[model samples]
Target: MAGDVRAASMTARAFVEDYLLWTRGQRAPSRIAGASGDVRRELVALRLRPSRGTRRGRPQITELRTDLTSPTAGRATARVIDRVLGAQYTLRLDLARGTDGWEVTDVSA
Candidate 1:
């Protein structure tokens, strides 16, 4: 039970980090690997947006916190604070554990 929660948290953290990178264009769309469902479609739609210029550099993940809302149901949510060119952005992510492992189901800013 505890192990499951830890795993889910880790999965969510990794996904959030990848998502931040993807948004900054440091990572390719195909590389946002832990996303699925609506979140995946959102990423596809965002492909047309221009990536951030290299002058700004990559975004830094300043803080990340994950809460397991339902361990038995394999559901979790994460709050992330990231810095981009000195600006901070807060994002919320919903995750679910499927047969393959944990995957991000939705994201909101």
Candidate 2:
């Protein structure tokens, strides 16, 4: 809610962010040959979706950011969903109940 991108420009920006992040981590973290493929996997993990009947000629992806919703503050486990350009994408970020604040335990995509 607080960090998600909702508008078209925001979506486009997020898409660029994910692509860049994936490419950046490819060589250092993955140590694989295909950095572009890593980018694809990262995009898919974001649960990107395009318009129906819009011709899936090209892929559309967005890198979303969101904090734990007020309602989900106390849950032991929960999946956070961020709406981007009208499509819902799961953030894959795990939150833990901390002493000071809710900290992100893990995140991918």
Candidate 3:
């Protein structure tokens, strides 16, 4: 017997978490499905951060929120709560539902 037939999908926040993991090199690119070409390329271009004198490590997501505008559209914002490079920056994302699942359509600082 087979399991549930429904296609498993991730929430907007979960997708963002995966994206952040990819950015930190904690997860592989293949782990993130339904991302746009540009998003994929950007992730590929990211390099690991070099350790500074501080004992602290990589940046971590402090807080995040997602607004599901519709069944097909979602907007999300993530903030780095930990101390690290670009920690002050906030990631804003626009997502849309594709044939496969929800994929990021746009990203802004």
lDDT (tens digit, per residue) of candidate 3 on 52-106: 4322445566767766677777777778654655346687888776677767776
Candidate 2: segments with Cα more than 4 A from true spot = 1-23, 26-90
Per-residue lDDT of 1-109 in model 2, one digit per residue for the tens?
3432122224333333343334333223233221233444554565534444332222244333444445333112222223333444443444433344343334444
Residue pair clashes in candidate 2: none
Instruction: Report the number of backbone clashes for model 1.
Output: 0
TM-score of each: 0.76, 0.24, 0.60
* Model 1 Cα lDDT, one tens digit per residue, 1-109: 7787777778777887787777666666567767886777778777655444632555665666666677534444444443444566777777777898877787787
Cα misplacement distance, residue 25 of candidate 2 (Å):
3.6
- What's the distance in Å from true for residue 1, model 3? 32
Clash pairs, candidate 3, are: none
What is each predicted model's overall lDDT from 0 to 1? 0.68, 0.36, 0.61
**Candidate 1 accuracy as TM-score:** 0.76
- Best by the TM-score measure: 1
